[model samples]
Every structure is written in structure tokens, then in C-alpha cells.
Target: MNFDNNKLIKIIKFNLCFIITFIPSIMYLHLVEGGQTATELWDSFINLDFYSYYKMIFFLTASFFLLITFLKYVDLNGIKKTNYYLPAAVYSILAVLSSFRAEYKEIVIKGFPDRYENIFVLLGYLLLVVVAVNIVDNKKSFKLILKALFISAFILAIHGILQFYNYDLLATEFGRKLITPDGLDFFVDRLSFVGKKVIYSTMYNPNYVGSYTSMVGILALGLYSSSQKKNKLFISGILSTLLFSFLIGSRSRAGFMGFIAGTVIILYMQRQFLKKHWIRIFVIFTVFTLVFITMNARNLDEIFSDVLFPRTEQEKYLEGEILPPITEVSSEAGKLKLKTTEAEFEIIMASDQIEFLNKQPINVYNSKDEVKEIIFKGKQYLHHSFQINEKENYLIWNYGAKSAQFYYQDGQILMAGMHNNLYPLKKVESIGFKGYERLGSSRAYIWSRTLPLLKDTIFIGHGPDTYAMYFPQDDVIGKLKFFSNPEIIVDKPHNLYLQVAVNTGIISLLALLYLWGNYIFSSFVLYKNSDLSSWKNRLGIALMGAVTAYLVAGFFNDSVISVAPVFWIILGLGISLTILAKGN
Candidate 1:
């Protein structure tokens, strides 16, 4: 009776920890900003209320668990003996120090202090590692963790599919609205067309959801292979299918690439297992691929036509099309009649400011507007307007001789003619896939502007999360022809490696890289040494493959609080598995 009771208590403890770990992903709760509100808190820091809440829960739960663990075990012997404890501790300390440096530097230089919440977040992750290692000490606990993860992912996958169809039953029937207290709303319409869809599921972005599903899906594959029971295999297969479908629906190029890379790694590592389950694998691949292609045919078509083979600005301008200038402006009608433009332009005059239409203007450039300098009684008058989907407003000031300076609201300036070759109005001509455009969506231009700025901050970095403040201040970036708009915030480096270098400094970045490198090395060693027939060995390989996929995806996307927790959890699991294998 005592043994049974103890077992039940253990199960309950494991279940509580498991549920707490994932509560943040699904629970969208926040402090209702009543009368007592800190306006400075809202303005000064990057709004991460959801993330902050999650970390707080994680910290409190972990602290409670640790206290219980110490009372029961009387020592931190288990964690102290683990190979990862020292490295993780060192990294956490570095991260906290980096945050301090960033906060101090930002306050001194930018006149605004950075939120050092990242320090607590990092510490929470470290505590998670310790807790995970302690709780998931055996195969039963490990399998339970996987089961919880699979179940969570399965629900999210279903949600994504329903959302893609515009049938968000949870939102409609249950009134399940995501709370965005900081005004940082993740509900974005990423589809180019009205009916087309790219599902974000419960995550903030499609890229995040894609990476998440990909990781979980790959882990499911490992679990499926390792299971001896027919029931376990059947369940895992269902999870894999659901996750893969969600990943495809995300339509994130980075996620797609990462999935492909992860799949290759899994296949390579599990080559022996494939010999027996080839038929099942083949069927899964075929069915999932067909479904993805069928659902996303229109999106694929748009990618080929709009992104890959759309006519360039030069090509469009050479077609002899010219946008007529505003000949007559009426303040009363809130409209401006251009000379010969295809569409009508609306002029809005408010707060002593005159601006063009709010939507994508009929013509991005007007050749007929020859008056470079608009002077009312010898005082230089500036015209300011914003483009569709643009973050920054631009001011048009006359330089000299039909030339104008476009000053981004953030102070970055671009000098160009009234009818500059780069700013020509062009209709997107679908010429089919002719390979990817040379520029690849202005990322190349942004990278070019960013690379030169990395020279000075190779040591201590510009401070944690301070990249956006300093990156725009670069002279070359400020003068860049394409991205001269200060309204456009370059918050992340786009590349995870570059972002790490910018935020955490080179020392911390190297330490992080070393940690990952060692994990990969150890996981590979364990897989190589273990029996091919064993499920445990295969599971380790699968985790290695998932990490590889995540690393590849990181090349294009920056880490965010929503997704980083899952990645850290996965890493912790891998470390636990490694330590267990060594003990055996």
C-alpha cells in the first residue's frame, strides 16, 4: 500500500511539473491594466508581458520544486555531478552580466534603459534544465515528457488547420481571445491574397510555429521508431502527421528549410530502422506532401510569380509608364486629381499637415512634379507621407536641380530625383518562376548595410537587445538607398548568430556555440556506441536531428521568448538522456 501510494505521488509530481512547463504556451492571461498603470513601464521596455508572466510561473514552480527536492534529498549532488551544470551556470551568469552592460550602456548612450528581463528569463531556463534533469531521471518520466509535448503539439496543429480554413472555433464559440496587454499583438494577416492563409496557430508568428511543429514532429518520429508497443507507435504516427501538416501550412521558408534539414538528419541517423518501416515512412511522406500541395497550390503560385519572377522597378519604368503629378489639390474634398494617373489620390490635411492617400498610393513616383522645392513666401515647405505597410513616415525636401532628399522619420536620409530609377511605379507581371530574384526581398540590401557596423562591436557587443537602437545610427545604413527609412526598426540581425554577437557579445556567443557543439558531439557519440536495435539509442538520434533542424532554422530567424523555452527544454532533455546513458 505504501509503495503504491509513493508511486501515485511520484506520478502526480511529474504530471504537475510537466503541465507547468507547457502552461505558458497555451495560457494567454495578463494583468488587466486598470486605473493604476505605469505609462513609463509600457514605453521604456520591449513589451513582453506574456513572456514575463510565463518566466515568473516557471521560476516560482522551479523554486518550489527545488525546495522540496533539497528537503527530500538533502543535497544538490545530482545536478552538481552532471556534465552540463557548470557550463549552463557559466552561460547564465554571462547572460545576466551582458544584460546589465546593455541596460547601463543604453541608458548612457541612447538615454533610454533596456529592459533586463532577459536576465531573469535566461535564469529561468537554467533552472528549468536543473528541474528537468532531476524530475526526468528515468525512461518513464522521459516518455511522459514526450507524451505531454506530443499532446500539446497535436492540439496546436488542429488549431492551425482550423485557423487556415477561417474556422477558428475556439475564438468564435469559446471567445478565446489572446490578451495583448502591451499592445504587441501577434494576430497578423500574412496572406498576400484575401482567401489565402498562413497559419500561426497559438504562436506569435508562422516561423515560430513552424520551427516548433518541426521539432515536435521529428521527436515524434524518434518516439515512433523506439516504441515496442503497437499502441505507442500508432499514437506517435498520428502526432507526426498532425505536426507535419501544421508545419507545411505555416508557409515559412525558413521553417521549410529547417524541416528538410532535420528530416535528412533523421533519415541518415535512422537508416537501419528505415529498412523495416520503409513502407510506413513512404506512405506518410506521400500523403502529407499531397495534402500540403493541394491546400497551398495558390500560395505556391504566388511565390513563383510575385516573389521569384515579378518585374523589377527598372523593367516597369522602361515600359513607358509615367505617374501624373497632383495638378489640383482640394482641401474640402480630401482628394487630389493627378494629371494622368490610373487611380485617384486622396489628400488628407490634419494638424497643420498635408499628406497623400493612406493606402498604397496609385504612383510611388510622379515625374510630372518638376518643382523640387515647394517654397511658400521663401520658407522651405516639406511634404511628408508614409507608404503602405511602412513603419516610418518620410519627408520630401528639395535638394537642388529636380533632386529631393527623402528623410526617414528616424533621421536617415536618402537623396534621389523626383523620378528616381529606383522608385518607379510598376505593376507586378507574373512571368512564371525564373529562379529567385537577385535581391531576395531586400534582405541583401539590409545585410549589406548591417555587416559594416559589426566591426566595432566584436568584443562586448552593443549590449543585450540594443541592436535596434544602435543599428539605425550607422552612417552607411542611414545613407542606404533602399532602407533609409528610420521608421523601419531593425530590431534583430535576422541571422541568429549575428543577433547573438550583437546582444550577448562574442564571449557569450562562443560559449553558447560551444555548448551546442558539445551537445551534438555527445549525442552523436551516444548514438554511435549504443545498439542500433535499442529504442533509447534511436530516441537520442532523433533529438540530435531536431536540434540540427532548429540550428539551421536559426540562420534565418531570431530567437523569441515564445519559442526559446521549448528549444531549451529540448536541449535539457537531450542532456538528461546523455547523462543517463553514461550512468548505464
Candidate 2:
């Protein structure tokens, strides 16, 4: 019985480590039919999307397996108590309660389409922390996990380098087939992800690629700094340089900032060690600098400009001579009119169809007594409701909570109000970062809007994975100023703190903050007391630096499933390492 239990524990530990190391690179694509009808603003045919579905399944299955095995091990033995439990418990309870009261129960359970960090996924994250702390009982296990992570980062960095040079492995036919399931050749052919200059590697978005490498790249440096052997040092230095080069290719300011933060932490923590080995640091920096310059030889100015001004400057909306779509109604018939400084035309809206002034009839409307909605490709994406006045006729088109109002004026259709877009302009509140609204790719705009929501979430939040449902999606001015698109959905706050505060309540945020604070404090105390020569102590510092980098970057990047699991697992390992160091 003991032998069987021991073997099971080893298997569970291996599975946990394997999943954590490889979760970022999981890109198996399968169709998710019947997407959310109300919330999805994009194509409705898919749900899991490309980067999200497989990662969720992989995490869920592995987490469940590790959790069940851990539970069995606990039943045979017993669980150890730690100071980390209180805050974890508080945060977990609040998250569960928030999910229970979520308005979109399905989303809270399964998560939003294209971004699945649902309640189950949240639980899985916590399970990672627990299992990581328990399963990693020795230095060998800990070193093994770090080595796997380093190798994964090395491979991904190489892929990112290839992508930067316009040689994306995934853009090839074989690459598409490699990511897609068998017999999905048609789906693979339909994929249009080729011809991208930026490098996102396997992490979906360039921003995410930045976030991921920021953590692991810094950790790679930590590994290099701590190693004594020449061979290990050489290998670690190469890994660090490669990873940092990948970070540069991502062009993610948040990522660069995160890398800086981690570097600062490492310097502060390993000041003595670094004083003796300053040459190594210089050599690694020189290598990365040369690589960065070589990779961006033609775009050096553009890269620097991006860092100086992170947000893309919004173009001023000049009142164009072109007229937007407008509806005009009389008792006799309804007409969709278009008038510009150059030309004017009208389309007659019949009871069930639209007829051009002198051309073919377009079967574009569904109506019994009056025209209701426009139909395209046998589907109605928006519900159109019209109101007529003595002056003009206006159309209010709604998709879920979002609505766009257009009014006919001077024979031209003019936009009146775009809900959720520029909500700050419509309503007044003491907004933060007033002058710097464009900072961090207009993260200030999102934060200014998101800050107002915290007052309502002091106790209980809307629910897990329901940030999109609650956020003001109709801020037209905000969208126009930040994104130049009045119709885009502001799905995430782009700030992890705001995401947690809005989705899981301020109380939960506080609990999580407490958990972070506890971990940092405990780790610091352990690090200060212990000798840095031991690989275990050096690992503790590396974990601290990596986790700190991730947290610092969280200010500009929200915790997505692609990168959040890595952070949580590293955090758990850090916690366990600290505890083990203190025990010694």
C-alpha cells in the first residue's frame, strides 16, 4: 500500500510539473460550436477560440488528476498547515460566493468565450498552489521543475526569434496541421494568421508573449547568477540572452517593465554574489544588446519610439464629406438615406425588403408591419429599433447591453450616442491619470473607468470571469480616443488588480493582496537568514524575482490563463521553497 501510494505521488508530481512547464505552448485547435449568443461581438460560430480552449482543457484535466492524487495522499498521511492558508481560504470563499451570485451563471462556471478563466479554472489555480507545495518534497524535484521550465522557455524563445524574422513555423501548412486536430485540414486552410511581423510565439498575443518571457527570462538570469560550474553558467547565460531577446521581439512595454522589475529584485537580493561576478552580467547584457540590435536593425527607431510613447496616438476624427447610414420614415414608407458633400442617394425600405432608388431589391429586412432588423448571411447580429420625430428619424441598434444611436440630420445620418464608449465624458467622476490617459496603451483610460466600479464591489463582486458582462462596453468616446473603433468591446480592465476587484470583490482583492504580502514577507525573512550558496536558497531568490516581475507587470496586463498558471505555480513553488529553507 505504501509503495503504491509513493508511486502515485511521484506520478502526480511529474504531471503537475509537466503541465506547468508546457501550458504556454499548448495550441491544439478544435472547433467550439454554438458560441454565446449575447456577449460575443465577433464571429458567433466559435467559442473556445484558438489560444484558449485547449489550454483550459489541458489545465483542467491535469489539475483534476493532481488534485485527486494529492487528496488520496492526504487521506493516507495528513496535510501540513501553513500561514498561507488563511488568505487563500478567504480569497477562495469570496471567489466561490462571487461566482454563486454571478448574473451570467454560465460564464462564471465555464468562463467567457475566447478567455476562459472561469470558477473551475480559478479552483484549478489554487489546486496548483496546494499540490506544488506538497508534491515538491526535495531539492531534486524542485531543480527538475526549474530545468524543464528553462528548456521550455529556451525552445519558445527560439520560436519567437524565428517569428520575428518572418519565418513563423505556425504560418506554414505543416505547422497549421501540427496545431490543428486530425481531419481538420479545411479549418487549417481557413486560418488567416499568416504575414504577421510581430512575434507572439505560442502565447497567442504579443503582449502575452511579453508577459511570459518577462518572468522566465528573469528566472533564467537568476539561474545563471547562482550556478558555480562553468558549463552550467555558459548554458544559463545563453538561455537568459535568448529569452530576453524574445522579450524584445514581443515589443510589449509591460513586458519590458516587468523584466526591469525582476532584474532590480535580483540585483537587490543577490548584490553580494553579483559584486564578485559583474563580468558575467556585463557579458550577458552585451550579448542581449547585440542580439536586440541585430534583430531590429531596420526598426531600432520604431522600437525606441514605442517605448517612449507606448500608446498608439489616436487619429482625430475629421468630419468627413461621407455620410453614415441613416434611416428616414414617413407614414407612406421608410427610406435609408446617404448624403455627402459629394453625392446623395436613398434606398426605399419596403415592408419586408430594401429597394435601391433605381436598382435591384435587396432582401435585407425582416418585418410584419414595420422593418425590425437587418439580416446578413441568414442571421441578425443586431436588433434595430427606430423612432421618428418631426425633425428626423433615428435608429437605435442594440446588441446585448451595447447600443448605437444614429440620427438623420441635414439629409445625412449622424452618430448620436455610442453606449459604453466615452462613458467618462457622459458622466463625471474624479478620474485618475487625468493628463496621461494614453499611458500604457491607454491603460489609464481603462483604469479610470474601472476605478469607479470598485465602490459597488466593496463586499460582493459581479462574479468570476464576468468582468466583460459588467464593464461599460458602450463608451464610444473612450473607444474612439483609445482604439479608433466605436464598436470594439472593452472586455478586460488590462489591470489585474482591477480585474480581481471587479470580478471577485474588493474584499477578495484584499485577501489576495494579503496572501501576496504574506508570501513576500515570509520569503524575504527566509532569504535574509539563509546562506545564498545553497542552490535551494538561490532558487528561493529566483522564484521571488520571477514572481515579483509578474506582479509588477500585472499593473498593465490582466491575469489571463496563458500566463497566470505559470505565475501561480512559480509562486507555489516559491512558497514551498521558502518553507523548506526555513525548516532547515
lDDT of candidate 2 over 229-287, digit per residue (tens): 89989998889988888988888777877898899888878888878988888888889
lDDT of 2 at 539: 88
| TM-score to native of every candidate shown | 0.68, 0.80
lDDT, candidate 1, 396-494, per-residue tens? 422221222332222222323222312211122222222212233444444554565566556566555555555543222222223434234455555
TM-score leader: 2
Model 1: how far residue 486 lies from native, Å: 5.3
What candidate 2 gets wrong by more than 4 Å, as runs, is 34-45, 182-193, 297-406, 409-430
Going through the candidates in order, what is the number of backbone clashes in each?
1, 11
Q: Residue 419 lDDT in model 1? A: 22
